[model samples]
Target: MSRAFRIQVSEGVQRIVHVEDGVQGTIDVLPILAPERMAELLATELEKRGYTRTDQDGELVLVKVGEGNVTVEVNVRTGTVTVSIAEEVQVNVSTTASGTAENIEDARKQAEDRAMRQLEAAVVPLQEAARREATARLEAELAEVRPELDAVVNAATAEALVEKARELGDIESIEGSAEDGNLTIKVRV
Candidate 1:
């Protein structure tokens, strides 16, 4: 069986955008880090690293986007962000019954098949252990990659905020950072 990891991003673009000049500015202005765009950027990054975007959704957002399994959700009123990516692997387990054929050769073959099936059942634990190891290895890689990912995202978010600020009115400065899985942006409106 083939194994793959699916990535999901929820609760993105969590920032407070105050329109000081609502009369002069566009009435409807959304954050730069929209959930759809967030998912696109993330998928682009993952694809560059060799993770094919599949059409099967993992365990996050209930909605499906395009044909891929990855889901990106956006909420303007949410303070919590959720991201989940999981690979689903199915294992077949079954035991065969002994044959009652009179022929010795047929009976022997049937017995062997049953024995092999029993062996397969017994080795299920080993398969689970290996799966756990694979998951742990992926988590370790995530810990190492998170910092760099955050750096890129942080820079992008800051740029978007500054751009937005300039678009609205006379903005003094823009500052942003990513910590504890939250993107915090402060703009001087």
Candidate 2:
């Protein structure tokens, strides 16, 4: 573990800090300030503003007690942290009608709200699947089966090839597709 250093925001007051991990005695100064300290200060400021941290149902606990745009998320399982930098987006969907103006405007507004809700519902699942796939790709890689392939190739005959295929696991069946001629091996893997 490395020593934690307090970043000087002002003369003596520190706004951000970082954990210095490297040599036994030397400090590793981050070019960028510590994200955790920013999160803490933001959380404190939010507390001052009368907002409180609350459980975000079952997805993840989001700490939204910040005064401004910064939002922090602390995962209960792994104790992992995430920060969200947000911006407000204004959407306007307006329509002009000749007769029955009130009904038309009300219908349009309702339709717009429903569309936004539907979009959110669909996008959330897609985003979750994408995140899962990305994480899996980053963390897992296919093992090289070349050596296993070589063992199977060195088999004396067709029957031995089928046995080798079965030993590799995940193989449903191995069949000689062609009558003779080098045996067109069909591998179900």
Candidate 3:
């Protein structure tokens, strides 16, 4: 006589997922002086705007950490700015299945396979949710940071322009607002 056996198996999957997004752009500061001098001026301006100078990878970079864990890094020498945010998500899923077979081992294998397949199916939705959450966070941070970043770059450019005008000739007067995005300098060479 052959006897059938019932077997049950459970499987679990756990993952720590990292989601990150960022924007990188160049600050359009005209090369009004030597590269080193321009970088120095930019660094000074950045410091005035609450960015702290720090060494990154043996290179000087200006860094600011803002609300929502957003980080802004400015490579003074290269006029490059990177704004980024990262989030960590934990995903845990488990499944259980039962099978009956003539042999206990065969039943256990069938149940295990079923459990594994259920876990595999759950993984995609979990990953998709994590990604959506990350993207939403990035969008919110960008909304808050965009105007401030624009103002900082504009002010830096205005300062550089004023310095360049001085080097070129005598500046009669300066006018307009950097915040307004209009700056005029009257220099007589």
Candidate 4:
């Protein structure tokens, strides 16, 4: 006679998940000068604002590491800026299952498989939640950084305008504040 057996199994999974998010935006530099000169002017302006300049694949990139592990990268040639952040989260999931079969080994195997499947199913939701949390954090950081980035772009644009005006002729006088988003230059050709 074959006897039935019951088996129970429990499984736990722990993972350190890395979550990241980013946003991309463009800055209008006005094209007041040649592209190369515009890029050079923007790079200089960003360097003055605490961004480090680096060349990536022959493209000029300015990088700044900010609070909360946020990294900002500006591509001078393309006027594209990317702000990104990363966070690590710990996920722990456990599941228990029971199975019955004629053979003890078969019962145990069935229980183990069920428990593992349950654990796997639980992991997806946890990872999705972590991703959402990371996105929320990124949004918050972006809100704080947006205005400052806009100001930097404005300053760079003002500087470019001044350089263009000089190239046009002779600048007799300059007026207004770049910070106020208004600049006036009088040039004599």
Q: Which ranges in model 1 have alpha carbons more than 4 Å from their true place?
A: 1-110, 168-189
What stretches of model 3 exceed 4 Å from their correct place?
A: 10-13, 168-172, 186-189
Model 3: per-residue lDDT, tens digit, 1-189? 999999988889897778778889887776767888778877887788788999998878999987767788989888788888787778999988998899999999989988888988887789788877777776787786667767776777788889889999999999997898999899999
TM-score of each: 0.38, 0.23, 0.79, 0.88
- lDDT by residue (tens digit), candidate 2, 1-189: 543332211111111212111111111212122344333333443344343555565533335323333344543223344443333222223222222223555555555555555545555455455444533432231111222222222332344444455656556544453223254444555
Query: RMSD in Å for candidate 4, one decimal?
Result: 2.0
Task: Select the stronger candidate by lDDT from 1 and 4.
Answer: 4
Which candidate wins on lDDT? Answer: 4
Give each prediction's root-mean-square deviation over alpha carbons.
Answer: 18.8, 27.9, 2.8, 2.0
- For candidate 4, write residues 1-189 as lDDT tens digits: 889999998889998888888989888777888998888888887888789998889888999987677888999999899999878889999989988999999999999989988998998899889889778777787887788777877887888888888889999999997899989999999
Deviation of model 4 at 25, angstroms: 3.0
Q: Where is model 4 more than 4 Å wrong at Cα?
A: 86-88
lDDT of each: 0.41, 0.36, 0.83, 0.87
Error of 3 at 167 (Å): 3.0
Which residue pairs of candidate 2 clash? Answer: none
Model 1, range 5-95, lDDT digits (tens) per residue? 3222121112222111100111122357565554554445444434444443342222222112222222212211222334444444444
lDDT of 1: 0.41
Best by TM-score: 4
Reference-based TM-score, model 1: 0.38
Residue 84 displacement (Å), model 2: 18
C-alpha positional error of residue 130 in candidate 4 after TM-score superposition, expressed in Å:
1.0
Instruction: Predict model 3's lDDT versus the native.
Output: 0.83
